[model samples]
Target chain A: MLYLIGMGLHDERDLSLKAVEALRGCERVYLESYTSCFNGDINRLQEMLGKEVVLLDRKDLEENPEENVLAGGEVGLIVMGDPMVATTHSDLVLRAREKGAEVKVIHSSSVYSAIAETGLQIYKFGRTTTIAYPEGDYFPKSPYEALKENHMRGLHTLLLLDVKADEGRYMTVNEGIKYLLMMEESCLQNQFKKDSKCVGVARLGGDTAIRYGTAEEVIKEEFGGPPHILIVPGKMHYMEEEMLKAYEV
Target chain B: MLYLIGMGLHDERDLSLKAVEALRGCERVYLESYTSCFNGDINRLQEMLGKEVVLLDRKDLEENPEENVLAGGEVGLIVMGDPMVATTHSDLVLRAREKGAEVKVIHSSSVYSAIAETGLQIYKFGRTTTIAYPEGDYFPKSPYEALKENHMRGLHTLLLLDVKADEGRYMTVNEGIKYLLMMEESCLQNQFKKDSKCVGVARLGGDTAIRYGTAEEVIKEEFGGPPHILIVPGKMHYMEEEMLKAYEV
Candidate 1:
């Protein structure tokens, strides 16, 4: 049996009671580290579950999952946030089932849903996009394109900042804003102006920090540490405007 | 302090350890019952938490949230799925803050993020729409319009089946599909053909059921019990096709 458990956002304590119970019955636990950021320490998680958790990088899960799945007794592949949020994990579920392994997903809190804390209506959010760090002349413009399209449809865009957990590098909200501006300048689309209203959320599902203002005001503001998310909101309902005003820094 | 806690998708055991702990310390706990479907028995949740849990109807929340917020001494408003997914709850958070109450949100797994388990990429989903039980002379065409727009943009549409929890009326996937077809016919727009492929997901984050086929084929298929979700997928990635094929019942 392969249990794809989610260690909900925040810390070890954020794990669902079902997840804790499932982990207690597992023989081996492997935490997928490449997908999202988990603020909790592994040692604390190990102490709570009384099971040794081996860290599995992207290569191990994407390229070589058979070894983890065929480990005999109940094997737990714990993922930060909801286990299936990442398509790679869903692919892993397919791989496990194909190999004749019974797979169960223990769901938990994810940043995708937690972004509602920013006072944006979840239903109004369009296709979510991710802003990644550019690697030497090979930058991706899809995130900007997605935001623009969503804005055109009068839908809010939740831009997830890329995080390489193993490499200890997480994209900050400021850097994400800089990249967005650069994309706008390069495209010369004028999709957003310097005074465009945007929202920056930092450390959601934990000690959250929210700032809502124009792109110029937000870009100059500091949104603390890692796991930052930016929201490019489109037409806001009257109630939504009032709710966002409460969170305006 | 007011705590908006999410009791994940399934049963009482789905509550996060953090939520459980916070509930343990709360003087009063009210479960918001109008937003989404919670399969767990309220008595079971009370027994597990060792506290009396009161059910708050839509009127109790929307019209008179002050009563819930002014309960004094660490009140907990437990919500099914992620606490903030419902815009009403977000409004409640703003109200709580207005009353000089410190608000802390404890997140949990939500259908918004759990839809990825249906083998669809989370990032590809456009604005989510809810299908309501049509009333006389008040049939809503917004959901259909949103679906058409998402389809135009080549994005998947996650149609939430409306549930009036207080009234114990949960919309099934069959009804949702029928409504969509009705809207398409009324609009006379060839947005969705009878043979258009769709996916029905039932009982997400629980003993889940998934079916993938044409709209005509899937509407005839039984998708178990309540809390069913329909997905009108746009262009599928090669990997998504492979993943959905695994569950093409």
Candidate 2:
């Protein structure tokens, strides 16, 4: 049996009771750490579960799943946030099943829903987008395009910051804002502006910090941690406006 | 302090370790039972927490929050799924803060992310829509319109079935499909068809039943419980197609 458990937002303590119970029955536990950054010390997680959690990089699980993830016995793969958000994990589930291993997913809090902390209605959110750290000469405009389409339809947009967890590199909220401004410069559609209202959230589900203001104002505030996400509001109802006002910097 | 904890998808066991810790410190624990149904018995949840769980309807919390939700010391308001997903909960957060109560949300699995269990990529989902039971000759077309827009953009749509938990009324997956077909009939846009491939998920995170097939075929399967969600896939990548194939009834 292979259990793909989610280590919800924040730390080891975020593991659901079901997740903890499943982990106890596992012969081996492997944390898939390359996809998303784990916000807490792993040793604490190991102590709580009373099981050794082997950290596996992308290659270890993706390239050689049979030998590593599905070697033998009951295996538990810990994924940051919900496991199925990324296509890679779903691919892994398919692979595991193809090898005749029974797989179960223990769901947990994901940034997809955690952004509700911003007081924005989750249903109003459009297709989520990510701002990747621009690689050499390869700047994609799809993120901006997604935001624009959503904004045009009067829907909120949750812009996920890029993270190369293995390299210890994370795109901060400020960098994500900059990426949006750069896109505006290229497209000149007025999709995003310096004074455009936006929200920057950092370290959600922990000593969280939320700042609501213009892109320029929020960029100046010190959000004080990694795993940040930015939200660009489209048309706000009076209630939503009231909620956003509560988080004003 | 007021702690709003999520009970995740299925049962009391789905509560996160952080949630349990928060509950332990609470002088009063209230379960917001009107918004979503609780699959597990209240006695089981009470037994696990060792705290008497008080059930609150919508009026109890919304009408006079101070006398109920906020009339307390270290209260824990357990919300099914993520607390912040609904605007009502966020409003309560603001109201609690206004009354000088410290508020913290212990996030957990929400249907927003749990739908990933259908083997569909979460990122590919567009704006979510809820199919509410039409009342007094007033049937809304917004749900269908949302589906059309998402389908036009080649993004998957997560159709949340409505639940009147207070009345013990929950829309089944078949009814949801019927609603969509009715919308298609009225709109006459081939948004959904009897032959359209879709996914019906029932009781995710527990004794889950997932069936992937055409709308006509899937509606024939016995999902066995309430709180079912329907997913309409957009243009699927080969990987998503393969993943969906795994759940064929």
Candidate 3:
């Protein structure tokens, strides 16, 4: 059996009871460690789950490590956040299904709708983008273009920061905004809509998660750390304008 | 303090530890009954959280029936699923925030992402649509137009069945599809695309949730009901097509 369980946000406790129930039933458990990391430590989850969780990096997914480990015993494939958040991983579910392996997905919290933390309209978002490897002057030109396009069509954009944990490089909020403004300048020069309206979301789904306004000018202000998404809102409903008033802009 | 806690999919067991912890601390909890109905009974959650829960309807929101109940006490506002999933209730948060209330949203599983249970790519979905009140000669044409536009853009549409607990009208899969097929036939009289491929998702987030294929002719032949959404997938990535093959289309 192949079980895909979500750890949720950054905590071991954020996991659902159903996830706990499934983890308890598994004979062998493997955690997909590459895509995301815990806000706390994996050791806490290890102690709470009362089971040893083998870590699987990207190479394991590509080369099929522990593929045979499940041959004789049941295996649990745990994913941080929500199991289905990544399209690349669902392909793994298909592969397991092809092998006649019994599969189940234990869902958990994800950053997708957590943008609600910003009090932005979830339905207004366009295609989501991640700030990926910076090879040149800017890293997320594509993401910026997509957000700009979403803004053009009166749609919001959710920018997922790139997380390459093993390399110890998680894009911080300040860096992300700096890269974004720089990218925007390079992409359109001055042909842009009102960039003064935006939101900065940090540590979503965590107890002390923060969602406040950065807008255009304030984004240049300082904010620390990884796991932040910048939002360039499209058309704002009046209620949304009031909602932003509550946040520290 | 008022915390809008999400119980997540289906039963009480799906509760996240944060939500459970809050439920434990809540001196009084008033559930928004009109928002959603649990797959199980309220008693299950009552037993799990070990609290007596009071039900609230739409009138409660309109007239502030909850004012006295939560005014000076530690109060928790429980929703059937994720509280923020229904943006309609976001006002309640703003209202409470106005009263000098410290509100914390403890996130939980919501059907928005859980609809990936249909194995459809989340990015492919365009602006989501909700089926509205079936008035004379019009069973909510806006959702139809939204879905059609998404289809035209080669994007999938997530059709959220409208919920009116006051009237006891939860748009079922059978009724939703009946209306959708009617719209598709009108829009694609000559068939603009290669096929009118669509998928029906039933009881998403619940244990017995299903993602049977309806894009095929087989779906037209085998259609079924309640608590569901219809998906019109635009362009299927090769992998997504393969994943759909695993189901009993």
Candidate 4:
């Protein structure tokens, strides 16, 4: 049996009882460490489950799943947020099933749903984009293009800051804002404005801090941590505006 | 203090340990019962928490929140899926803050992220829409329009089937597919074809069932219960296509 469990959004306590129960019964547990940040304590998680949690790198799990992940016994792979959100995990599930291994997915909170804390309606949000730290000349304009498309349709855009957990690198909200400014400069698109209202959410599903303001103001506010996400709003209803008031800088 | 807790995608066990602990400390607990269907046994939930869980209707929770939900006590309002996904819950949080009530939200899995179980990338999905059991002379064109918009952008569309939990009326996959066909007929748009591929997901997070096929074939499939969600693919990456093949009929 191969179990794909979600660590949810915060500490170990964020895991569902169902997940904990599944973890307690697993023979070996491996935590996927590359996709998203795991805010929980590994020691405490292991203590609670009475199992030694091994860290699984992206390459090892993706490249040699049969040997490292599905070696006959009941093995559990823990993933940050909901397990299947990443294509890699879904691919692993497909691989496991093809090898005749029973796969069980234990679901939990993901950033996709936790963004609701920003008071933005999930339905009003368009395609989600990620702003990665541009390496060399590899800066892509897809994120900015996606923002333009969403903004044109009067929709909110969720900008997921890139996370290189393996390299101890995580994009801050301010960095994401800077990337957006650069995108605006390069694309010369009127979609993003320095004065446009934006919502910066940091440490979501934990000790969360939400700030609502223009790019100028929000960039100055201290969010106090990593794993920050930015939202660029297109249009809002009166109720959404009222909710944003609570977070206004 | 007011605690808004998510019951996650499935049953009582789907509640995080944090949620269970919060419920234990609450002086009163109220379950929001209108927006979505609750799949778990209420009695089991109450028993597990050692607290009586009361159901709150839409009118009461929205109109008389002060007296019904925020009456100077540590109250917890349990919601299906994530607490803030619906605009109503976000409005409640705003109202509570205005009344000087401290609010804490415990996040969990929602259809927005749970749809990842369908093997589609969350980022590849566009704005989500709902297909309601149309009332006489009150049918809306927004859902079909949203589908067209998403399809044109080469983004997948998550069509949330409406649920009138109070009336015990949950839109099945077949009903949602039929609604799409109706929209195509009415608009004479090439966006939704009768032979277009569709994915229907039922009972997400517990006893889950997923089927992928053409509209005609998927509509003929027995999804086995309420709380079913449909996905209309706009464009597929090779990896996504491989994953969908696992669910193909």
**lDDT, residue B201, candidate 4:** 93
Candidate 2, A1-249: lDDT as tens digits: 999999988888889989999999989999987877788898888998897989998889889888778886899999999888877888888888888989889999998999998888999999999998899999999999999989988999999899898898878889999999999999999999999999999988888899999999988888877889999998988878888887898
TM-scores for chain B, in order? 0.96, 0.97, 0.87, 0.97
What's model 2's overall lDDT? 0.89
Error of 1 at B225 (Å): 2.2
lDDT of 4 by residue, B217-240 (tens): 999999887689999998999888
Q: Return the clash pairs for model 4, or none.
A: none
**Residue lDDT tens for model 4, A1-249:** 998898898778989999999888888889996888877789998899998999988888889887778787988898989989988997898888788888888999999989988888889999999998999999988999999999889999999999898899989989889888998999997877789889999989999999999999999989876778999988898888988888999
**1 versus 4: better DockQ goes to:** 4
lDDT of 2 by residue, B102-129 (tens): 8889999998988887777787899999
DockQ, every prediction: 0.84, 0.86, 0.62, 0.87
For residue B113, give model 2's deviation from the true position in Å.
1.1
When sorted by DockQ, best at the front, the candidate numbers are 4, 2, 1, 3
Q: Please give the CA lDDT of all the candidate structures.
A: 0.86, 0.89, 0.70, 0.90
The C-alpha RMSD of each candidate to the native structure, in angstroms, is 1.4, 1.1, 2.7, 1.1
lDDT (0-100) at residue A8 of candidate 2?
Answer: 88
Candidate 1 chain A worst ten-residue window by lDDT: A64-73
Which of the two candidates, 1 or 2, achieves a greater TM-score against the reference? 2
> Candidate 3's residue-wise lDDT over A62-145, tens digit each?
566436334535777777777887886767777777677777777777777667766777777777777776876545477776
Return the TM-score for each candidate structure. 0.97, 0.98, 0.91, 0.98
